[model samples]
Target: MASTAHRVCMAMLALPAIALAHGEIVVDVGHTLAAPGATSARGRSEFEFNLDLAREVTAALQARGRSARLINEDGLIPSLKARPQAAEGAAFLLSIHHDSVNAFELQPWQWQGQALDYNDDFAGHSLFVSRDNPDTARSILCARIIGARLQRMGFEPTYKNGRRRAYADPMHAVHYYDGLAVLRHATMPAVLFEAGVIKNRDEELLLRDPARIARMADGIATALVACLTAGQPADDEATADGPPLQPVVE
Candidate 1:
């Protein structure tokens, strides 16, 4: 009886070590106030969307007992190359941004008496990896895992970016965008997630929904843990430990 008790105690004590094996993940909020990536159908800046979702993702990762941090949370990261530099020492880097359509696809509109442009043609999320990265293999692996998980969570992948020329995994919509500065320059495996096309009015509203934000964040967090510990034995205790994240209020 004492021997069984001792073994049980040892297994309980090992949980933290198991959780720490995944290392730190840096969640990069793509774009800055000065150069916000895109404008939403209603004229909101993409930086606003990126920052909010990145925070939720970081929170979700932490809830899983993983070490995750956020960079450019303040909207001050100055340059493309500098984004990855800020993520040094992390095991993985994920840059988050909302998507947009090409200028030709956008039509002029009026919102709240202000002129705006919007495209209703595109309406889903996309994932990108850089073949030029030093850790391209792992980057692709991580992106594929994320893409698959996102789809399973009911998030559709969109190819409206017109850059489906090099899909690392077409079914899940993971693309190889070789020149992306953040992915190319990262010292660790990295992926750039275009969360959804904000220029699509319907998608813009959906992306802003608090419950959907929580779902997306939770899905990404679960996928990251799975990717980082892919070869290890399944830990039912670890996988089932955390509760679903609450909807983000902001």
Candidate 2:
């Protein structure tokens, strides 16, 4: 008869490996409905853009045989501080957002004979990761992979930040934003994607188009699949000593 330890080891070996395709992915819409983020050049709320893209991304992931959840509760349900905790068991968390420039950069314009704010100076998408997260390495890896896919899909990345912006490198199109609440607090690999600069007149219209949104969703879904299947990157170090970073409104 086998020893008790040997029997236990054998039983452990008999269990099947967890499949990456079945891992839970939480797609977080950037802001609450009541506090909808930046306004687009056309007067559209950023929350609308974030919610739409997050839903599409969730659908795309589900179609690819991945378990995806969208965490888009109203301001009353899960407060901003609670959103990340809501995604506790997820393997990955992706927060979707639309970018806007500083007020100083915004130029006054007349759209349909009405005064509107617009900023055509900067355009394109951006990716962000928080070093404060427990899975910072995996988060960075995921961000890089998604950024690469977005670029391959013919979408450029924004690299222009005026005086006030400090989180991004601009040159690499990926930012190390330790202050972002969602990314910083997530226990799993977390990334925040600024899909595009909505303040740019031309980009705002593109962001509203269903076809473009779908294409971007497909790219994001593909990146998520690749990241899971490829496994987490080699750098799995976790840091807990840094000063807590402030949260930046998306």
Candidate 3:
């Protein structure tokens, strides 16, 4: 009993050392990270270029001496088709998405053929996750960490200024009981990041810039290492601090 107590004490002392075993970060491009099909409108959704962004971030993380992996977008389809699988062997899962006002386009002539007097109030980017307890809070915090990094990187996002807050009612804000399929079905604590307003023409043009995309990836990677996993620091911290992102012109 005396020897066992000594060993247990040693193990307890080492807990913090192991706290940062920072596992792999699995990212699922909201649409599909793999090759795009003709049936699927490539580069149409906000995530059209997500895979590319993933690659850049993956490389950056590796360069900074972080252990990470990218799950093929194909693997995500099955999970999205239904409830998430068991988190079994993952540290975290991140889903990248882009939203536009296109959802309203599908439901035109609302309110007795009179268009609803609603403005496309939603603008800029947001980092969101589930609202469940403990694990969900941690995931949401991780998303918030990324959001903080984004702000540090000089993207003055307009925040959660959407007209609606519930996914059933709001075109966006889908990350809980009514979240997007991928976010809902993620086996692990997952976050969905709407990088920008793809619907806005000005924001749409910003997406085309490779530099901005790279900055976004770097910001994501930095946030994951600095905040999410507590990975070992390699050198100077590099964030996605680029130019002030322009608002999407209607």
Candidate 4:
């Protein structure tokens, strides 16, 4: 009996891992409660927005009968590298985040008697992928798919921040940002989605709307499913070259 059981276990281990490769889509919630990311115009933490939208996205995916997992749902995952490690076998990793501008761009404002910083110059969504990722091509493909879907749903793409950002797809606002730990450390295809510029007061209000949030979540869910089921684009089809390390004196 022991020999037979050992044989069965060895046979199971020998099975192809193709099914495991097509595992659950990991929706990683950016930042943690203790070290919440960028602060919004209305004093809301970026983590709050990320968690909210991630929840909706996960639910939407499950509704479509797709395997989905939400990482850092409790806002407790502290290490950036650990986030990707948790998604070791995931088909893809989408890190949800709210955007903010540089400190110099922020203008002082009063919200309910409290001083706050905000930037209204840029308003829109942005997508990022890391060239260091093993599946960089697939990462860009998925980013483009999500960006195009968001654009089709009436969400414009932001283009003002060009300092250290490189446009992988200018039309879709997909940037090749190799510095993002979550994207660079991920073994599977990965994308860092900036849902909107929360620092832009006007856009912040729009993104804060529950109905609009639901729509955005739906768009993400649809795009992810399409990317996963669609044919994989040729590796050469996606090019990722990040910006130069030093600024040009000229």
Say which candidate scores most in TM-score. Answer: 4
Model 1 lDDT tens row, 9-66: 4345332323335789899998897988899999899999999899999999999988
List ranges where model 4 is wrong by over 4 Å.
1-22, 238-250
Tens-digit lDDT track for model 2 on 30-102? 8776789898888888999998899999999999989999887343435766778888777788999999998
How well does each candidate superpose onto the true structure, as a TM-score? 0.83, 0.83, 0.63, 0.86
- Which candidate number has the best lDDT? 4
Poorest lDDT segment (10 consecutive residues) of candidate 1: 241-250
Per-model C-alpha lDDT, please? 0.78, 0.76, 0.51, 0.80
lDDT of 3: 0.51
Return the clash pairs for model 3, or none.
153-241, 174-179, 175-179
The regions of model 2 sitting more than 4 angstroms off are 1-21, 73-77, 161-172, 232-250
**What is candidate 3's TM-score against the reference?**
0.63
TM-score of predicted structure 2: 0.83
After superposing candidate 1, which stretches have Cα over 4 Å from the reference?
1-20, 162-165, 231-250
lDDT of 4 by residue, 122-181 (tens): 999889877656656667777888889999999898986455687778889888777778
Candidate 3 per-residue C-alpha lDDT over 1-250 given as tens digits, one digit per residue, 9 for 90 to 100: 1244443442342213233346666666555434232111113534455566666666777776777566554434544543234333455767666655544442222444444322244456765554321134345446657777877897656435344332211222323332445444454556777776654545656765789988888887888777555533121111111121222111
**What is the Cα root-mean-square deviation between model 1 and the actual structure?**
11.9
Query: The CA-based lDDT of model 2 is what?
Result: 0.76
